[model samples]
Target: MGKEQEKEVILEQMEERAVEEISTHDAEKSIEEKLVAVQEEIAGYQDKMLRAAAEFDNYKKRMERDRNAAMKYAGEHILREILPVVDNLERALNQGVVSGVDAEMKLAALLEGVQLTLKSLLAVLEKFEVKAIESVGLPFDPNIQEALVMEPSDVVPASHVLGEFEKGYYYKDRLLRVAKVIVSSGKAAS
Candidate 1:
């Protein structure tokens, strides 16, 4: 081969190699850019997940605080209503010891005051949806009445409530206390 032709061949080969290297470099740069973009997307998703978790924790803590407050303040309204009755009883007792009144008169006055106080208390209970259970003359119910004794009676039928020892009460559709009563047995067996 001639010298000039050989040199020209070498220069062409070098130019081709340079082009391949530049193409390879561009490909590597493109891949690096895509990697950085994918990493940024992952970081953004992680930040969102962390924020959601923090929000859920805050929600749980807020609910717990509200529940505790409700528990702490429970029955406060009922006790406030009952306190006036207590005050009335105290007033009655204080005035019950007035001088110049006879013992019998004082006793009567004190009893009247107690009756009024009891009526007031009962009214408050009624306001709060408390009601007395009717057991006398009704058939004995195990759910609301407790049988104290069985007595033979001509008037009351068997398994019927004859007399109540203590009145039962219901507080807002729920039983507060069971009625204690005597059940009657049908006329004695001959």
Candidate 2:
């Protein structure tokens, strides 16, 4: 081969090598750009997951707060209903003492005042859905009455309530207290 031809062959080989290197470099750059885009998409998903977790935490806290409040005020309605009865009793007692009447006169006057106060208290209790459990002369019910004692009696039937020591009350169908009562044990009158 001649010298010029050999030099021309060498130059052509160099040009081809340059073109291949350029093409490989362009492929590497495209791959790098795709990697960056995928990373950005993953970051967006991570942010969304964090936001959802925070929202769920807030909802749980709110529910807990509401539950605590409900428990704290569970008997508020019942207490509010009974306040007026206490006030009426206080007023009756104060008025009876202030009159300064004789013992017999005072006793009669106080008795009447107490009856009226009791009636007013009953009215208030009824308005708030509180009802007195009828324990006297009725069959013993464990749910509404607690038997304090059983006694031989000529009144009513055996196992029936003869008297109530303390009144039982119901608030809106829920039992507030059980009545302390005496039950009858059938025996002939002496």
Candidate 3:
């Protein structure tokens, strides 16, 4: 009712409104700061996931390349071993044709060279798990021996191997070649 009282009442109401506005602004600022922190944490996790995926892809490609290289060179070692055998054979043939050597002496030297070369080849084969099969004086086996002819013999019993035209061979427990052989029929008629 009085002018001074009315003025005091208006000042108190304005002060209360200012206090409410300041409190609301502070609450809004705190919420904004929390949202920024959460967004940064999410970005860091995404970066780590991307890096892990790239590393896994690189590992798979490297393994595939190594496997292909291994397959390509699988038989390189075996071919290297056989090259020396071929060289030895070439030398033996060349020695057989040397001029001024006596015919008998040349023949003996050639034969010796061939025998040595054969021994060396056999050694190489053995190193790779290849072995010769013995057929002479044993019972004829159709599984491993091919009968070239039937012959009558007193020394070899019926159904036995008379002789081998070509020897059989085994490579790692499996038959590589069959023996070409003569099989005994029975004793000859008097």
Best prediction by lDDT: 1
C-alpha lDDT (0 to 100) for residue 134 of candidate 1: 91
For candidate 3, list the clashing residue pairs, or say none. none
- Preferred candidate (lDDT higher): 2 or 3: 3
lDDT minimum window of 10 residues, candidate 1: 87-96
The prediction achieving the highest TM-score against the true structure is: 1
Worst 10 residues of 2 by lDDT: 91-100
TM-score of each: 0.77, 0.67, 0.68
Question: Per-residue alpha-carbon lDDT of model 3 for 69-186, expressed as tens digits?
Answer: 9899988988999888899988888888999999898888889888989999999999999899999889999999999999999999999999999999999999999999999997
Q: Candidate 3: deviation at residue 94, Å?
A: 1.3
Error of 3 at 37 (Å): 10
Q: Give the candidates in order of lDDT, highest first.
A: 1, 3, 2
Off by over 4 Å in 2: 1-27, 62-77, 100-105, 123-129, 171-174, 187-190
Candidate 2 C-alpha lDDT tens digits along 5-64: 999999999999989899889989989999999999999999999999999999999999
The lDDT for every candidate, in the order shown, is 0.93, 0.88, 0.92
How does model 1 fare in lDDT? Answer: 0.93
